[model samples]
Target chain A: MLHFKAEIKENIPVSKNHYLLTFTPLAKTPVPLPGQFYMIGIGNSCDPLLKRPFSILTKSDDSIRILYRIKGKGTTLMKEMKTGTVINVMGPLGNSYPIPKKKHTPLIIAGGIGIASVFYLAEKLKGKAIVLYGARGKHELLMLDELRGLVKELHISTDDGSYGKKGTIIDLLNEFHVNDKHLIYACGPKGMIRAVSEFALEKGLKGYISLEENMACGIGACMGCAVKTLKGYKRVCKEGPVFNIKDILW
Target chain B: MNLEVSIGKLRLKNPVMTASGTFGYGEEYSDFVDLNSLGAVVVKGISLTPMQGNPPPRICETPCGMLNAIGLQNVGLKKFLKEKLPYIRNFDTKLIVNILGSTVNEYVRLASALDEARVDGIELNVSCPNVKKGGIAFCADSRTLGRLVSKVRKSVNHSTLIVKLSPNVTDIKEPAKAAEEAGADAVSLINTITAMAVDLKTRKPVLKNITGGLSGPAVKPIALRMVWEVSRTVNIPVIGMGGIMNAEDALEFMLAGATAVAVGTANFINPSSTSDILEGIKIYMKENKINDISEIIGGLLIDNPDD
Candidate 1:
């Protein structure tokens, strides 16, 4: 991993309380894979202290994009950033999503801001995957047009019934026909991911789920962002941000 | 022009060392930092057996700092000697292993084993606040600290024995003096301060451990004060650390009578913090026309009316 200052290319509001930030690295960095993340420094000050972790939303030769919600001090500060603002970035960290077997069909599930973690994976699937995207309302369903254009099939839901089939993403999953031939990839709140984990297990479907936690050193040194699993506690910044669905204890 | 400093008989090429629990095994940061540039690399706190650490939500960012309750998770002494030791031996820097244990025998065993392997230093971690046993217990009382240090000192023949003191105590000088009298070569202070954070929405503690050791720029002033106090109380060299983020902070520790300084939380913020601080120190020395880094040790000047 490399740590260098990157100049912001764009910071645009995508949906309610959500934004897409793109930056060009001042130094050459390894290509980041889907499901991998970068720790973005907030400001040039120590008040916010630790760098915030963001998943790679998209990447090109010159710039990389990350979708974030203004939920805390770090993101709020990030939203005010304009083009040409240089910020420290350490990246292409953690493991990437595994490719589905040739015989298996890819099924991607995302909830609310969790869409940021899987958007790059959808792009990699190259129109071969089916996506189930959900949010609190239609305004929070970010980058719908772009996601639809990339995937072979796209389904959406909102808790407030302001958009596609009302209710949780788990409710929408109940109507879908899933089996061992379908490979599931998910990222969402703990409740949604837990429900999806159980659903995938019941159907005997193999899958991977991206996890999130408050982290200190984005490297393995701090051991701060640990998540319990069948084998043992794993660092979310190192051992994962993505894990085999069957491996998670909860 | 000289940056060399001695901790007991161990001579470091410079006074900048990576704090224990922050630098890992020296390999995790090899890609971002040149281990050869560091004066010393103090690995994470190791125990007799591998520890799993605390549960999730082990850390939370606070104002100007962060709280971590990692519970001293380590690969155990066996793994360190077999796997970690060999990898770090490739680097030109001195290696100091930070050891933790539940009893005096455990500490003695870890010290002798590491000394037998010929590591450069052994830092006794008696102030890690996250664990339930062995850590803060030994250092809470000066008497107990003295006994522990004396026993560990006996087992350590080749390596330097540095007792890492706790800031949670009433007076930091007691343990520093005790460690010195008990044959410790040097003393490092302060470990993270005991602190906590709460979530209003959930009405619960932010960390599953409820409380964690506070470190970062927030604790720097307190650490500096404690280092100054202990440095005056003890004859042995003082290794100062706690939220040392930049060269200015590291230099401040030296002015407060610290012979050497360790970079801890700054490593998490910037992986190359130790190297950066070392380079900054050199620049500071050159700009001020200071020839030796030792000149800055205990350099703080307090005007006296009598003078």
Candidate 2:
């Protein structure tokens, strides 16, 4: 991948602890895929040495948008970054989400912060999908308008009953009663993935899960993010940050 | 506009040198960086024999740095001379070989093999934190450090030898003095400090190796302090490093008694850190109206207890 000193064009709050960052690259670089991530540095502060990895929420010819939550020092620094400030970025790394060939009934499930990945996925497959989004409350329910515009059937559920259906996102998924003919995709907290993975497995539905781990060198060289699977320990950064539901051990 | 540095008799066009281990044999970063523009490329720590290094989870992120426990994973001196050294010779920049050994004899053997090759210099990697044996073992005692350097010194005639010191010791001066007495032409300090990152949730050590060397901007202050201390202790030229990301930081090392500086963890964060530091140093010199940076060596005033 090529390293570009990018300038921040926009930074806006999408939800609590989450913001959308748009960067304009200085040079021509590789276009980011739906699930691919970028390693970004916010400022010259000593708190962050390496760039923080973020999912490519959207991509265009010259600019790339990253959706991230203010969880740690790196993200906090990123939150403070002003528009027009330059930061170093090296990425469009990791594997992308598999694109569906035919227009199968698309079933998109997002848990809590997991909604970030589906932004780009929905942007690509707009008007031909169904989105089931779950969050703790209305404030945490991110990109609802965007997802609603993209999908045909939009289902919203909050744990605190602040949104459409008062229950867990998975609870709402169980009530959908969709047939096994649909292709499913999901991202969110680990617990949500395990729940959705088990549910999708029993229902005999085709689904993919975007997993998360604390990665040092987000490339394969570090081998920090190892997930147990049928093929033994596989690197999440290389093998599959996005794995088919059946491939996951949990 | 070609900037280079000469460590003793060996000459490097640019003062920007890649610290060992972060750069894998001067080849890993070639795709991202112009290897020839660098002052020198020091490969990973090579032992007398091949090493597997530590188990999985070899690295972890610290406050503003990284802890790495890659226990000198190399193909040994024989393989290096046969394979790695020949390929490096084809490049334009200087190649400094960082060697780690278990004993004095092993250091001698490694040095002898390096002397036979077309390499520019040898940086005795006596401070690698990854290995439990032969790496930091040589740097613990001044007497042993001197003996290790002397053995390598006597073995190699053509190559300039630099003894890299560890920061884990109580007093850095003792080892710096010992290396000087052993006829080391130059010295580089400090290597990563022994550190461990614990997962608060799991209540277990983050890295598989319980301990690893900490590097990056987090260690910059500590490295600068040690460089200042070691430079004052030894008369030989000192190559300073640890957490240096920019030219101002590199200049800080130079002012604190380092003849040159190495950019390690910064390379992981920014591919252009080395070049940026080089450019910054030149611009700093121009802005400060300083013709030569050599005038600023040991510029810090020693704190006075009885003023």
- Which candidate number maximizes TM-score? 1
| Candidate 1 C-alpha error for residue B233, in Å | 0.8
* Candidate 1 positional error at B298, Å: 0.7
Misplaced by over 4 Å in model 2 are: A98-110, A125-134, A137-139, A148-186, A190-250, B1-4, B25-28, B46-90, B99-117, B130-135, B146-159, B181-185, B196-212, B287-307
Give one digit per residue, the lDDT tens place, for model 2 in B32-74: 7787777888887788777665555677788788888766666
Clashing pairs in 2: B3-B13, B3-B14, B4-B13, B4-B14, B216-B243
Candidate models: Cα lDDT each: 0.93, 0.80
Q: lDDT at B158 for candidate 1? A: 97
Error of 2 at B73 (Å): 6.1
Ten contiguous residues minimizing lDDT sum, candidate 1 chain B: B127-136
Docking quality tier of model 1: high
Error of 2 at B299 (Å): 6.4
By lDDT, the best candidate is 1
DockQ of each: 0.91, 0.23
